[model samples]
Target chain A: MSLNDPVDDETLLEVRDLQKHFKVDEGLISSLLRAMTGSESDYVHAVDGVTFDLKRGETLGLAGESGCGKTTTGMSLVKLHEATDGSIRFRGTDLTDANEEEMVQFRQNAQMIFQDPFESLNPRMTVYDTIAEPLRIHDIRNETARVRRALEFAELQPPDQYFDQYPHELSGGQRQRVAIARALVLDPDFIVADEPVSMLDVSLRAGVLSLMERMTEEFDLSVVYISHDLSLLRHMCDRLAIMYMGKIVEKGPTEDVIEHPQHPYTRSLINAVPVPDPGVGRERVELAGEVGDAIDVPSGCRFHGRCSEYIGDICETEDPPLEAKADFDGSQKVACHLYEPAEGVDSTRVDDVTDTTAPDDSAASAND
Target chain B: MATQDEPSIFADLDDSTVDESEEQVNRWKRNLRLWRETLGEQWRMLTNDLLVKLAMVTMAFFMAVAIFAPFIAPHQPLNRQYETDAELIIADWVDPMFIDSESVYVLGTTAEGFDIFSQLIYGSRAALLVGLLAAVFTAGIGTLVGLTAGYYGGKIDDTLMRIVDFLYGMPLLPTVIILVALLGPSLWNIIFAIIVLQWRSTARVIRSQALSLRERPFVKAAQVAGASDWHIISRHLAPNVLPMSFLYGAFAIAWAILAEAGVSFIGLGDPNRVSWGTMLQSSRAYAALDFGVWWWFVPPGICIGLVVISGFLIGRGYEEITNPELR
Candidate 1:
């Protein structure tokens, strides 16, 4: 992977070790009390360290369980939540260091589609005002023309018909479409769609998803689709990154990751999805334990407590780095101790390393 | 829900409503139209409540009486008739058509020989002036403070809320009494006192509301759209919190009127101005109730009650509209 290169001609968004931590304290009084007592203030490590590259006109899916920091990563990419550490470069401009003018320029070229269409739109503003707001903010001319075009693209036909209507007057599908129109009104280069169709009815999901696909292709937009639904990600994304507790455990082509998940966490996540066909019976790989709180995250790997393939003290004591294995092509990377770092090794398979260390799979499972 | 096939009701109408040549004019017209729509919706909600309707009617009567006080009153409020040596008597038998000096008193003459009917009519002006000014200032200051504090929380919220909490400790009547004493008795001073003390409630209420609304996804969406903090507060947050502030404005108006009355009844009213409270104060000095001079004190007292009840009715109706959970 071109991880060493900060800027590439084709890479639209390069996020390196992004982290966003939220204070766990209630209010200022608690902060003052904590200060007076000389105790460490606790924090929710929401997005600890995530790294990804989004190529121009590419759709990257961030698949994770709830609270796994997929949404935070998406938000940080758009500079909605300022990353606590690391860097986010959008078209070679460092978003973290962007000043007022640069920030404004960045905002004009980037947009976000929130999960809840009902809440994402200003209830007081009409459809036209909501879509026209970005144009007004940027002082762009011909706002009526741009807003009408966006509405028409969103499939709200005869845009003038819906201009006066409020979000309350629209159905779930229509409301989501309005939100899409608002995001697209800016003619953004990059878009962060945080579960855009999750709130809509299942029947309405396909239409909105197809609209988004059309938008990505039509605008040549680099997009990040954040969702816990693997099926949705598999359908929309070209490249998929599976996240577990604020870290991407595996990343590869969507088909490769879905068909052959290397990391135990990724395998368990894929297995959790129910198969619609009753004829094709597959063994369900249920993992132990619940998702840990972000406050007191487990030491080594975050998924160690939940992984069924718990490998002894090595898994418990050492943090695993995301590295490509010799068995697979260099494009796929997995973050598990089962796969030794293949950077210096030559043609070393995963089982060859596990045989010398653990002797047997059952023995490693017994260590749990 | 509107679909592609089903066009809106006004689809065929031309853009004649907002065809202004200038951008500022168009924006202003759009805002005015939005306000009209919001107000029309609110009016529909208020009209459903009979008490609110009655309250509006009562307020209209007082406002009309205040606006046309000079035309409505038979004599100047300050015109005291010492030529005839009038005694305090109920003017029930006095003929209003005959403008004789002795029968000129409509409701009755005070011991000071001031026409009670004239005083009562003109008193509405002072009551309304104090109420409207105090309410507007209080609501304006409170809403601004609340939106600021709630939008930029942390230290700002702490400091603003602490100040509000400190002010909330002030007892309304005593604070106004002391304030008027220091400022010297005047209509403006009473209004100033009421505004200073009354705005805290509105600030606290609106702050709580803005705090919750600040977390809504729409607010985040606005931020992502590169809206400045000021624009977000004024354009987005202000409209959302305004209806609640108006509800508080109604309460503030009622409070201001009553506070002015309380301050005036204790002999701190502007001596040059004739308010309902000043009339009550004067009647008390002559023991109008004790002497069976009901018209001297009863009219001003009833006017105060009517205005306060109307305020409560309007507030109740507005509360139901703003928070449908209450309905």
Candidate 2:
């Protein structure tokens, strides 16, 4: 319901200042080498300062290019990756601070569906064993009835046909359905789907997406759909959040964000989607800039180095707080120096509706 | 063609055009082709390599010799039938299919005038038993330890791996011989010794294999599904880890058999039981290497070589099947 943990009673899950940092070179030899080099600041800031909320039965898309930490954000919510810092209140219970036992209890309520269906399902297990796994783990229904119900839930009709079948015997779509069945069989309240349809064939993508959309409504499940594909996100998500360098840059209602992307990074992401028809050519904003390394995130706004609206030193020195703008709907929030009232800029005079085109001279393009 | 309307390209053709009476004649050809394709894939997977087939055949031969020793053997392994010159008498090697004289020893006699052929046959059962049982227990212990170590990882993995390393660094065969000698020979003592030494190799191999399997997303998926540690190891990790562990387990059988021979040759084996090793040890003129007495040592020695060779073959076949990189 809210991207930055807004004060609202309807919000079912609220994440604030979430971060998942991993230490590099932990092995003895690697540590020795690192110690000699004095590279103590060897932390991979995988997900930093990410905040959001999901209302009950809402589908919020966490969109980002690869290595932008959308997957990490989704994973951290389910306590798959231990959060380095921050808090996640799932309907008022703190998920970020929970220990292993507590997380196991959290796991029953929240589940994750991974990207690669082929890699996610155990190759050795039969379809029944695979789907029956979660049910057995949580000490749920009778094995026979549970497996059949899960099989039916995932749209694998006539459970007897699939009961003894192994993953290698099935097609990619069926395998993904098995993965979904494994996730959904437990009947969790929240689901984090990390590029669930990305690895699927283009033709099969719709079927899987529609099945998930149908599951969200059928189960009344609050879902976080993480994907790099904006078009896919547009179809699947009610609200969308675009991530850049381990932080959410812009987020709002899917239609509102697609129409009026407040952040330059969000606009560039929307512009990057290749038009299907060869005949039609829209005015495209080509983002020719070095994507910043997440490890060495730029001091100010991480996007300032490549921002199309190349403002003064304020963009480089100060990080902009996410604030509501009047030009678009009041609900959408963006964190950019150009949109918000900041040092050295009169916010009222700034053109809020114009295209923030990349300048002709490429000097301001990310040199990092 | 339809009148004015086009016939759909996607429409199925009439069966008469593709499936005529000629199909009956070609049925055998079709069946043969299908069989060949299936066999081709299987052959590449398990038997295309000459060594694997040789291993399989060798194992089969040894198994048959052990299992049917009583029916096949002409002379009793422990009985000496000679009235005089019992040590010097060598039975003329007779064809196995046609042995008329019970007095004529096939493949000559041992130092005690007991038939070498009979001893070789009786000896095979012990070799096979020690080799296989040792292999089974070794792999079982190794897989269990490796699974726990890999799945639980951290202090448990470190402690178990350290124990493995401690065992690994020892002079294995000599230590085993000394231990077996102390424990005293019988089939079980030798087997116990072999298992203790052999399992480390298997455990190390399986542990490394399981370590890799632990990181696979399927394992993590199970972890997230709230599957307990035991469940994840047994269901998700164990299946992928099984083949490699079996590969090492198979090879361990060969080594265990060889080690049994070595211990038995050192006079540490139960002399009451005749094995390939004991036969080698008890052979007349075996240590002296005398002339015109080739039969004294050659049969049992050859049997030992064959058994070890068979074990290697079987082990390697398992390796080829289990290893993905080789495939």
Candidate 3:
């Protein structure tokens, strides 16, 4: 649903048409070479036209491979990287237009949990100071009590032992716990957790994830959980959005999307996840080519080059709008020409083969 | 398989009975253990190096003497009336037991009849002050400029780096000479000359370090925390850049002291002050080297060597502390 719908669900954050482009400059000699070769200058579209909503008390998993704009999207949410073009609305307030003073207030309500716990934490600072930093910056007067409460909430108990420990003294899991404690110390409602456990060891990853899950429920936190792992996303995220080359390819309820992925890229990602059953072997749907450069993305559908079920001419000529998939609940949306009846696929016939629950009427209407 | 199964049996039992307090205690114990381990590692590195220990002791001694030089010296090195013209030429050459010649000039006299021992003691004050002042000024300005340029890479970086390049290409000694010529011969002018000529080297080094440090995830974390640019630069960036700045500052002081001495020897220093450089200058001018007056020049030269060596040792010790790979 478009954000214009006057629904009152306390939408904590809304990002629309977010774009970040980095200009690549060729050296003098390289420019001369390019001039001779007639090569055009280029720009990397790090986050191209990303739009999403984060309702209060809901976790939205933004799933994507490396360089797929997930981290860029997270960074833009906090205004760490300025958006080239977009509107980021928080509590119906446009953060994109927020000045320095306004941003400081916004930061008090919104915080971030970084990817690598080892590197994200300041090695020089003790755990107490790291957690206390936000309290000090935001001018939360009751410093000691707030820090103690935050440490307690993060499941780092006794608080006294950890208060004096530096980041290097803590293990990977402990460090991640400290990072979480630091984020929660501000008592923020919304948080962007950017691949928070990706750098931890496999054995320790679950502990961090569980702690996050507990913290999310305990604090009533709305989080944008960014990761490349589909299994973890399915477990933690209420809703899921799969990204490819800086664009959202598919989005739906976590279980719905995982069980019946509509987009080819989403299907490939789901199938790629290793199942626990060693006996039940499934064919790995390996896409033909590598992801295209974000600097110069291919024309029409960005995934056309790597899409398995590409039509003869339609996929190359027209960019597909993100419309409701045929025979699925209106909750699910996919951006692909293959789902459109106008592209020579019959709505009823396609719906019959694809195991989608909703009727094809909405899909057909969107196509028309 | 049996051993693994046995562990799982214990794990299940442990999971069921896991007390939250016990878990907390375990985490605390583990962190404390790790801290102790890292401390041990650092201690091992410190104790294993004989040169570092020797250097530390030497620096401590030099700093102690430099701090207390005023109280320990018998006569004020700057006092001219205590040194008479008669004592300057005749005292050492005339008698074997000239203890009573002219009011406690124990190390004999300069051409101007200044006590050589008193000058050596008080000379450290000027050398140390000028060296420290110039070092601090150069390091502070260089670090600020370097961090800003390197961390926020763009046209600003390009421009500042170009300035660094231009300064780096100029011969440091000649540039100092020209500046001193323009400013006239004085202690302040020498300090200014040293700071202007030496800051570029530190700027280049700090800039390269900042370039690498900016990419560190901690910096990115600071950004995500909604910290203002100034806060991040001062609080986060400056601390990481400080150890290197300190190391550079120590080396810069050594060079500044040497340069000051060179200028003073050439009569570009304070004319009235009885510095080691002035002693060397006057000794040479009076042909103490041509005559058999070894005591006239040897003490000042040795003092200069001691200062340079002590500075070098301190710098070496600091380098070892900051560089984990070497440690």
Candidate 4:
């Protein structure tokens, strides 16, 4: 039942303890105000701790609301923001310690697809230059053929038509396609798509997402598709990892996670998704509480304040570890006290295992 | 509702409008539209700003003077009344600003017995040339250095910015004069001094611009694509910094002209030519001020002022268009 077990299916990237925190030096006046208010830190914990595995020829969806660190996790995986502290291994080579030469090699193999299609492509550059750039950089000098190939792959057919056009002239969907083409030109094995279709129109979103899905099989690519849309993730991802405030609270096979979300946060997110029939209202966990500030993160469970399944002092004092749910036998993982038998909730119990340590047991599903 | 699903209101439009097969015409129209969208916006702003419009007119007028110097000049600028003082045809003592239909000396004559009007016209050419050439060179060098510094942060940024800081602390005009004085009077040397002092401001401004732009997602995407430092700087940073380059170029031209005028005014100019600055210098040298010959100095000074002001206006107009907050 544990599909997430560490299978020997050609692992491409293993991102562990990925953290990217930005210091906010908000002037003398703000410092004075902070001093008076007794604030602890002046840091934005953008990606406090994220851990995930990317298998070759697999699409992993990172789902979370805005400011939940999904994008940050994706960015740091490619060393875009420079992981504050973590290890990212590519095919067993530790990328976190990679020198410039090695980093360049890593970049050649792993490309990034940014969120904003319109803003990510240089407005001044023609579509040819945008796609041709990666080819030129990686020393793939046969530019015309490669750029044309990439363009075709991105489904911008009649490559000649789009070759000379700038980003402004292209439609939003076309622009995103060009971005995909730019990422594809290098023939990279791994691609981190950070909310790739988030800024795209609802009508065009499905097309781009499916194109990404098509790319996985075509190129044999290991892709991390980061988005907040559960439905979109359902369609695109083989495995899903739901993040909340810079931590992955639940992760498993996409279908299983969507069907039976174990984490309180994941359940709320799934419930929030609009159903076609208005009368079939969701028995949603109506979370109504102040979202905790990133700088002043709450002790114990970060989600305890807004969690509907507030397990009294246990939820408040002991931050729940992401654990493989007892009944599912490691297929579905949830980070909440309710899943722990020691915390007195046999809500979704199996009675198969003893109480396990938090950190050692699960930072991420081992996928063994 | 879908935009294409809606029935076309212009069903009865002209044949040309409906002809989708006229590909060449359509291509030309597209080109026109793109050009109009980019430059037309700036052009519209230029015309809209009263000060900028006035500046453009003034610049056009002076540019015309520079271009038509050979034809408009009443007499050759180097022309003296005599090869030697003994054979002087026009007297130095002739009334200032005296115009005569019979003589080429429309603005009378200077103390050197050279036509003042001719000198002013010819001087326009030097002013425009130095101003333009210096500004162009400055913008080019500054932008290149800036792109390198900003795109490649840390040591390169520190070193280049420190150099700019060093240059900034130096009194630009005074140092230029001293350098020119040492190098001797020549147009190229004057240009060299101005350029050395000129590009610092452009570099500093562009460096900051490049810094902000280097952080943009597009640039990061380029980095993720395995683009080298040179590739990022040239392809990404340079193009984005172009609008600012233009803004600075105009301003630099104005400052260069002023700097040249100041240099020549202090007798550190190309002694062979009669720029507006040199004309003023000559007036002082000949003690024309002592003789109450006000016409000799006034024309050149006004020309320098007008040229510099025009450059400022044009630059400001450009800045307004490029900077959204300013607009």
Estimate TM-scores for all models: 0.90, 0.79, 0.84, 0.78
Give the 10-residue window scoring lowest on summed lDDT in candidate 3 chain B: B1-10
Of 1 and 2, which scores higher on TM-score? 1
Candidates 1 onward: DockQ, in order: 0.35, 0.20, 0.19, 0.23
The residue-level lDDT of candidate 2 at B288 comes to 21
Per-residue lDDT over A1-368 for candidate 4, one digit per residue giving the tens place of the 0 to 100 score: 24535577877888776788988767768888888999754788888767777777888899988998888888888777788887789888898777787887788888899889878999778898788777667665445666777787788989988977989999999999999988877767889998888898999988897788887876778889898888888888889999888888888889889998878788888998888887895686877786689887787778988987675776666666665555444466677767632334342333111133453223333221
Best by lDDT: 1
Per-residue lDDT of candidate 1, residues B106-148 (tens digit): 7767877778889999999999999889989999999999999
Instruction: Write model 1 residue lDDT over A10-103, tens digit each, in one string.
Output: 7777787788999886676988998899998898999877777788788889998888999988888877788999888877889888788888
Candidate 4 has a TM-score of 0.78
Task: Tell me, by DockQ, which candidate is best.
Answer: 1
Alpha carbon lDDT at A223, candidate 4:
89
Which regions of candidate 3 deviate over 4 angstroms? A1-8, A28-41, A327-330, A341-368, B1-105
How close to the true structure is residue A11 of candidate 2, measured as C-alpha lDDT? 65
Candidate 2 per-residue C-alpha lDDT over A1-368 given as tens digits, one digit per residue, 9 for 90 to 100: 44434545456788887888977647788888877999775788888878777887789999988888998888888777789988898767897666777677777878889889898888877787788778667765344555566677778998879976778999899999989888877767789998999899999988888889888887777899999899988998889888888888887889889887778888888888888899987767767788887677787778888887767776676666554543444367676766533223333322121123322222222321
Query: In CAPRI terms, where does candidate 2 land?
Result: incorrect
Q: Given candidate 1, what's the lDDT at residue A141?
A: 64
Query: Could you give candidate 3's per-residue lDDT for residues A31-150 as a string of tens digits?
Result: 898889997878898887777778877899999889999998888888778899878998788987877877877887788888888888877668887887776566555555666777
Give DockQ: model 2: 0.20
Q: By TM-score, highest first, what's the ranking?
A: 1, 3, 2, 4
User: What CAPRI grade goes to candidate 1?
Assistant: acceptable
